[model samples]
Target: MPVNDTFGDVRITTHRDNDDLLSAGLGLRGLAGTATRFVQPASPTPEELRRRAIQSSWKGIADLGPRGGFGSVYGSIPHVPGREFTSFAYLPGARASHRVLLQVPDEFDHERRCLVVTASSGSRGIYGSIAVAGGWGLPRGCAVAYTDKAGGAGYFDPADRTGVQLDGTRVRAGSAPLEFEPQGLAADAGIAVKHAHSGDNPEADWGRHVLQAARFGLAMLDRAFPHEAPFTAQNTTIIATGLSNGGGAVLRAAGDDKDGMLAAVVAMEPNIHVRGGRSFYDYATEAALWLPAALSARQFDDVPFARVGAASPPAWMLRGAALRAHGRLTSLMPGAQAEEALAMLRAGGWTDEVLATAASSTSLDLWRAVAVAYASAYLKRDAAHMPGGFSYRLQHAAGVAGPIDAIVRAAWWADGSGVPPGTGISLDGGTDLSLDPTLPGVLTLRDLQTGHGADADQLRAAVDATAAELPREGLPILIVHGAQDGLIPVAFSSQPYVKWLRDAGRTPVFWKVPYAQHFDAFLAFADFGDRHAPLLPFGYAALDRAWAHVAQGRALPEDAAVRETRPRGAGPLTAATLSLPPN
Candidate 1:
């Protein structure tokens, strides 16, 4: 059994015994069990969908009552009306609700008759916002909705006690009701939807979310716009799309809601599900992570729960973020805390060197190497063996504490494989550990497991429940993972999902980009620089293909698998190279 048959990091031989090791090693910082509230979708009748949708409306958005309680984040921005809607998500807790900072494109076409829903991979960086504002889905001249993941949404207040809600509504003990605001898309002549909370699905809250959002959004398109397509799950096709987590979620949503609503699903650099046979690793594979403090703070809203913006500490936030991450890179080292040392650097205005490397360096090692060289540039002598006096202290203090965050975390959790799926520690969650402007350390595994009041039981539940949903038969889909994806090992979904779907007699297209990482890049780029542009066309292509198939029943090429490669030098994407089964 190859390693890819199992979880990317989990060794087939060791996974059964190392569940805790696996979780802790990945820097999950929470003791999450598999989630509950699982939905094993059989075809839901329109009446069932309608009745449930109606009930959801009454219990969901109706509680908020129109868009009255919601406030606009973008003040006086023409063409793009950026608004935030506070609603409930599916999670297990007193405060299981979430919200979306939506964009209603000025050019939204009611006549185009499509609602493009985007999932924010892990809810970090420009996760869902770009997809909505001007990225993939939004550019299609359709309405766009974006939100943070459950982990992203639930990071504040570190204690197990639920954090404060954005709208300040009293959350009851049981699962908090989902917040749905289809009418909020009123500006776009389309619809809006706030599904279950954005965290790992602890209670398996996803069952109702994707469906409800689709049904309600479509119903609104019909009832309000009238001229727009009147799409019931049966009548019209809906496209489900997302990247990483969102990518995985959309595919799961389409699988679970098979033969309904979803005309197709477009998952970009998604962590897909392949069948885990007798082992976690079907083959040897590597994983990657995107750390914080990289390029423009990844766009968080000004809300209290947000990591940046008005609520966080002013002087030390980003610096603190980098500092906090030092140990994960160095990993349980004897001494020389990067967090403390970084503080010293920040106080002296020395953070720019390492940060500049972080922004440009494609790999974490380059980031670490650059930082070490810059820190030691002032050394009196050239490289030599044991230098006792001042040199020993200086090198031990700073040079040795190089980046091991991604490495240590991946190794610890992945059965010593050294590459893990997804980021175990939360980028935003790092803020919870400290506020020291200079040092304010990132959240370490110890901090995640013990420091914060994370509920072990709840964490366990969310972890298990959030596991990728297996692809079942029934939906015509196209799953694309960037061959260049350094994060969330591609084998996670590509191999296993293909195995599962094939076993189930389902045939969805799977495409891998030769030079894309999470998102594909143009010529010559394996995966960095001018990042967003390379992926835009791929995203649009996936959706366009899915829409054509789901809505029009058009047949796609029989090429089961293909790798998209670009020219050696900078240029546009070259045609894909298809893989045919051996004769």
Candidate 2:
């Protein structure tokens, strides 16, 4: 009888002695048995072996039967002697639950191992798969039995030792509740207390809830891959990254564990600090004084005296001032020089009809007056108890105002130049202040300014800290900045961060998309112009290359292209403008 080699390299030669054949069969069966022991075993048949071989690409089994019918017959047999199987389990904890599973291969190699886990599951039925391929080919007697703990959900302090579960396949334990309190001026001025959700307490304790959820997820991972444990080295590297609120949390986690736990981090648009103090007040004061004068000057033809003694500025004027202070007023002010500002505005489509409405002198004057009003309201509601009745006062006293002002002024100048153009008033369409109409009308400009400042600071700190830990030689860091971002000026945030990283011997790439605002840039990959079109894809491609370098443990290219060669999208002002100068 002809013998065949079916299960990989395992050679099966027909033997004359029945005892020898039985012993060989027993040895193969033992190997399969060891692999399936981790999970509930499913009785295997000849048909199953054929299916397993096809799935795993084990050539040894293919030699046993006919082409198409081989798998059917192989799957029908009760025992395959040398095959593998897998299964999983879900365990619940005091605060959360977890899912654990087993992964086995036909032949066990010391270096090759398997751990099955649920990657994704939803309304669809459950499915199981291995995290890593190949079974650790261990010599028959040297294999160690997998052990771990199971689940339960509750606040288990890392320091406390209660309600802990440990088993051969999984482990579970509780952790301390997460702590969250408002930071910056919001916390310092005691506003958080007055605004507290309910009861006598002014602050909400939602951190505990979030912590419980995260811990539960961790527990699930623990149960699924019981063989793996949290990295224990004192100097082992830990990297954390996230977007928006999650980004802020990741940065906080890294900072909190800075000493030894977290080694690196990547947080995008984190919200860490609050904007409070004299700087804010100063901007309000400037807006109040400057806006009226600016608006009066803009109405050289109509509404000449509108800014002289207006009862109340128009809503559009207030929006304009707020936008200007936030480094988003490029549309209102244009031209290379102040002399050309009016002409540039007119050329961009600001008509006399638009000016004749005179709801509040000129848009500039209206903006200033509105700024003052909003500031006054904010002082009353959120900063009444502060030293100067405003957080901006302290900031001015501390000498930080100069630097901050310089940054804002530079951004404003850029906005006017059409360099980083912003959306502005038009001949036909009214101003489109990107505020949601459903929100309370009582929301003052001061609140918007304060929130925007706080969020910007947080993002800056997070990015800076994260960049500090990254290896100078790794992948290139791509920075995307919206030219017309009102909440966070691209020049102040992304530009400065990139400069700092490069100065520190790191490869940093930057792309400034025109006309694109903060939220819009994230929503789509746009082409600005022929010269700057591929900007978005360039960033993504660079990121991919960086990841490739990371996998190879090599540094990213320093001289790689950092600027785009095609137009990506319209700049902020470009999008707002109806007419364009001929090339």
Candidate 3:
């Protein structure tokens, strides 16, 4: 049976990992797989270098934060009117010392309304973002608060890579795990506790992570502000919103809000509802997903897919040079398939000369996309700061992702297992019957490597158990997706959830943004792509409607068309301009 437990009286402590960094590396999140099975971590980044240089403190302030999340959130809350940023320590899970970095809006009335506990881009950006870009909904009667969720903060844009020197070569920016001692920062920030435990960068377990996040929200409400019923969303009463992983989390919270703590969720471009296919899946989503992996794999010294003929290729086969990237991508498939893809591109006027230059080739871009996609799906998706061993995180994900991928390939791959695994409820005694509402039809990260099938029925049960399903009652959902989303297919990510809502007899407000990709790239480009951008105004607009109903029972805009235009003459593209045709 799954562990069914609860926190007695949550104890807040300085956020710490279960093991020290050096130990963690030798432990679970440590050096992974055999020499034969390839997966590796990276050398520290420029930020990490700066952190090491800082060592201890600057005037007793923790020197570690300056390069990343520091200064503004610590000390006294900034005296900005209609806005304040602060950090708090809380126990989300029992004894789990975590920090919730927050930015409270100016319109916040601690005594009456509740601030929508949201997320900041990367570690914490939304709290300090430009509103036209969809953050800190100022002058809109909207109040906000956010947390880092983990990893100190997520990757800083362009696939979370920052260019760095490695072996005298300029490696593209990618996920670089670093450990920072927080003694000075914690004390200076006034969040230090007597029994300070330590935690480091760790792998992700959505089940545990979401539970802690949900708990964090309630704790933030009770401990950080005056205990009110919390700001509402009309019918559901309490509302939660976030982007990307944060978006997926609020939905998880709603499903697990057994005490009726939440009423609705506004999840933008969530990762759920993605299907099993890898090769023959969403072209756009896959391309964007893999780009980072191609770059990150270099840090691991991965054999390029161009050389797949050498050793049958490792699981994460991605080696991309800016020059030969297109040819490398086509070689992933055997024989005729590669020919087919190449012919398609050739027919479209993609000559060799065109393919050689990175900017000119659609094929090269696709190569970069799949590279990052594989890296993310396999090694880097839930990379965050947590209380566990690095080895455990890696193995946990691998055990789950590897086997799960196998099951997926078997059932969905055309050249896979003849017997297919159908959707929803599975017959043949293959699904885990224990649907524990909070994490229904889900497989905890630990469960990933726990069991695999020698039997067909067993594998089916394993596959069925991995999905995330929760209740829809009381929670009116407003799913806003971009029609042109390249990170997640609007069809795969949102349409299925719509089906679930309908099946439950609930009418969720599903709105699609025209010409919008996974994010507001136009706005992001204007900011020089500093952070992981939010979905276009559609999500925020939906939230406004939801809040209106909650605040004064106003009606939300009934199905509507939301525009997300990039300005003319936009090159790389920005939300300010209309998106241009493919080059």
What TM-score would candidate 1 get against the native? 0.47
TM-score of every model versus the real structure: 0.47, 0.32, 0.47
Q: What is the TM-score of candidate 2?
A: 0.32
Query: Comparing candidate 2 with candidate 3, which one achieves the higher TM-score?
Result: 3
Winner on lDDT (2 vs 3)? 3
Candidates' RMSD to native: 20.6, 22.9, 17.5
lDDT for residue 91 in candidate 3, whole number 0-100? 35
Model 2 lDDT-worst window of ten:
122-131
Please rank every candidate by lDDT, starting with the best: 1, 3, 2
Which is the leading candidate under lDDT?
1
**lDDT, candidate 1, 468-560, per-residue tens:** 554445666677665544444454456567667777787877765544444221122232322322343455566666666655677664433
The residue ranges of model 2 lying beyond 4 angstroms of the native Cα positions read 1-219, 230-239, 244-314, 317-478, 498-516, 521-546, 557-562, 565-583
